[model samples]
Target: MLKAKVGGALPAANEAMMQRAEAAIGDLRQNFKAWLEEEVGKLEALMRTARTSGIEGEAGEALFTCAHDLRGLGSTYEFPIITRIAASLSKLIETPEQRAAAPVALVDAHVGAIRAAILQNVRNDTDPIGKALAEELETRVTKLVGERS
Candidate 1:
């Protein structure tokens, strides 16, 4: 039986490709701050709309979507603390029933924290203040939402 070629020249080519990929990612990193800011701005707009319309309708759903997107994008944007806080916010309003009962102040706090992190350059949990804020928000959200799946 004939076996497939193992790891010869392919490994070298793969290594070169990996290096190129890393360089591309590094290039993209420069734009991450602006991208993250745009996302946060959208989230803030959604928050305002949610406040005006109440959390039981379309605006609330949009707010949840914005938070979910921020949760997924935060780490990619070099803001892992944002990911943590956004995750907690996502959990707190994941469902309509939860949104109906979710405190506007709590949602406002999460958004405010995200804005503060950006403004203060607190990108991750390594920062003491960022860590404390993320932990507190997560704790509060868990108490209300009973942990997210």
Candidate 2:
């Protein structure tokens, strides 16, 4: 009984293609995570500065848009940390009372905690895009805080 031995399970070429596809998907995930982390850093810094000095003019508008964008992205990606942080931020400005009472120190501490969580607990498939972005945002945040003060 000449059982034509065709290769196991997947044909070699098909297996190779599938492997490539998986690798491509992995690459895509890495890129997306990198992008999201950069975005988060930017949002955190903006929040920090706005909280510290009180946002104003075009910057205030930009900050609000940034918060809104982060919430939408966070919701889409199912990043619980991002979603919660963004929700807290949005609530701070949701109503007049909330906005008037929200404290700069509170926002800074909460966001600082979240940033640490992301840096320590969250693992992105890519390299340290988050690290680079965090550093850049850190510098900008310091400068903004100083300016506001």
Candidate 3:
């Protein structure tokens, strides 16, 4: 019986298989971008509803869920800034207690920031505008939560 060497180069067949898999996934990034944009639109609509209805009960929960989903996907889709902004929004409305008291102005700030970030195509944390926006959101969240506490 022939034994394969450990920690050695991959077998030629295995290497070929890996290459084929990579090729198959070549369009994955493009598809992800399209899907991410669609999801962002849905999130925006949820934000609108939350804004009009006030972020409480079902509306608040929906907004939080959308923000959580976007937060999770942003980094994977090469939008680290989105991840940061979404994280802020998610944190702001994390609990039912928090959601009940969540200010519409604060929620609007967060949602508007997210929409601006996406519409302006801010992908990285290095962008000055993205950085500023993130900081502003963080400050607003801190101030509002502090006032409530």
Candidate 4:
């Protein structure tokens, strides 16, 4: 038998596995991004209604309902960030005091965190919920505190 080349097969196999993994990640990122953009549009509309129609009003309720529906959809996709924010914003939508202004900043913070997660590929598997949204709420609360000072 001719001498076999021992190392020759390993590189090709490793490359193929890496390619498969990258492709899978790419698919998740692309699909998740598309879904997130759509969800963001919905969230923006909800916020606008909460601001304009009055979060306590019937219009705000309708918008909140839409947001809740979106949250449910996100849950189906395991998009915990969207789901958590939608839930938190539901309470804010229902409240609609001048205090509701707080969640506006909260929404902004969530947007920033989402952008970061996308860029860094940081998976929130430990909590599986609400870390980004909580950060957002804290940011909003802090902003409100700053405004008062």
Candidate 5:
């Protein structure tokens, strides 16, 4: 009798099942893109409200939460540049004190970066314009946060 080796290879039937499952999951990309677009719109709205109403209290917290969520989802949806922009914004408004004292201009800069990245279809971090935009936003945010401290 032949003995099956542990942790060697998947059986033929198991491999075929895995391939079929992968193909089925691949078809969900379009649906995921649609959902991501809707989520981004909601995030944009939240940011606008924070900008107009002043970044404080519930509005500020909501904006921060949205940015954080975007940061996590950006790479998953093939938008690494968005991840970078959102990460910077999240850092800028991480603390309540930071949010309360955050300048409107700084907040607007972050929101604008996010909007531009999405609208321009900047999926890669290495894209020349995307790189510049991410760097500029990160630098400005870092400077502003430093000044606050």
Candidate 6:
């Protein structure tokens, strides 16, 4: 008697599923720009709060959360450059202790870069300008906090 594989579907089935998934993603892509803009607005508002309340208490924690969210969502929004920059920002203030020590200017710069990346349609590191800005921000963050452990 013949037996099927225990753990997976046939290649043809997998390919069909992948095609469907791609179509779904294509449909979602139409909304990605608006979604990305909304997320950036949230980040900006959080940054404003951080400006007044400082980066140690609720405002700082919220800022980090927003940055973390943006880092995760950036590529989904077709803006991998935002992901890189937001990742840097998230690393700079992931913990309360780090937030307390984090420089306001660095935080603001990261936010600004993410905003600019979206506004300028710099979607990924392929753009030399976006790549350079992301790398510079990452370098500064590493200098202050070292690499992620």
Give all candidates' CA lDDT scores: 0.91, 0.55, 0.81, 0.55, 0.80, 0.92
Candidate 2, lDDT over the whole model: 0.55
Worst 10 residues of 2 by lDDT: 140-149
Count clashing residue pairs per candidate. Answer: 0, 0, 0, 0, 0, 0
Which run of 10 residues does model 4 get worst, by summed lDDT? 1-10
Model 1 per-residue lDDT tens digits across residues 1-149: 12345534333357788899988888999899899999999999999888888888999999999999999999988899999999999999999999998999999999999999999999999999999999998888888879555
**Alpha carbon lDDT of residue 1, candidate 4?**
19
Task: Spell out the clash pairs found in candidate 2.
Answer: none
Specify the poorest-scoring 10-residue window by lDDT in model 6: 1-10
Ranking by lDDT: 6, 1, 3, 5, 2, 4
Q: Pick the candidate with the highest lDDT.
A: 6
* Model 6 lDDT, residue 116, Cα: 95
Clashing pairs in 5: none
Model 5 per-residue lDDT tens digits across residues 1-149: 13455656555677778889877867776776776787688877887787677778888888889889988988877788878888888889988998987786877787787778777887877789889878888888888786433
1-149 in candidate 4: lDDT tens per residue?
12355634434457788899978866777576677667666666666665665544665566667666756765444566556555554444444453345445454454445445445544353543447445555455445544332
For model 6, residues 80-104, the per-residue Cα lDDT tens digits are 9999999999999999999988999
Q: What ranges in model 5 sit over 4 Å off? A: 1-25, 146-149
Model 2 residue 24 lDDT score: 76
Runs with alpha carbons beyond 4 Å of true place in candidate 2: 1-27, 56-58, 95-97, 122-149
- How close is every model to the real structure, measured as TM-score? 0.87, 0.51, 0.77, 0.46, 0.77, 0.90
Candidate 4 segments whose C-alpha is farther than 4 A from its true place: 1-35, 95-149
What does the lDDT come to for candidate 5?
0.80
Deviation (Å) of 11 in candidate 1: 7.3
What is candidate 6's CA lDDT for residue 40?
A: 95
Could you list the CA RMSD of all candidates, in the order they appear? 3.7, 13.4, 5.8, 13.0, 5.8, 3.4
Candidate 5 local Cα displacement, residue 77, angstroms:
0.6
**Predicted model with the maximum TM-score:** 6
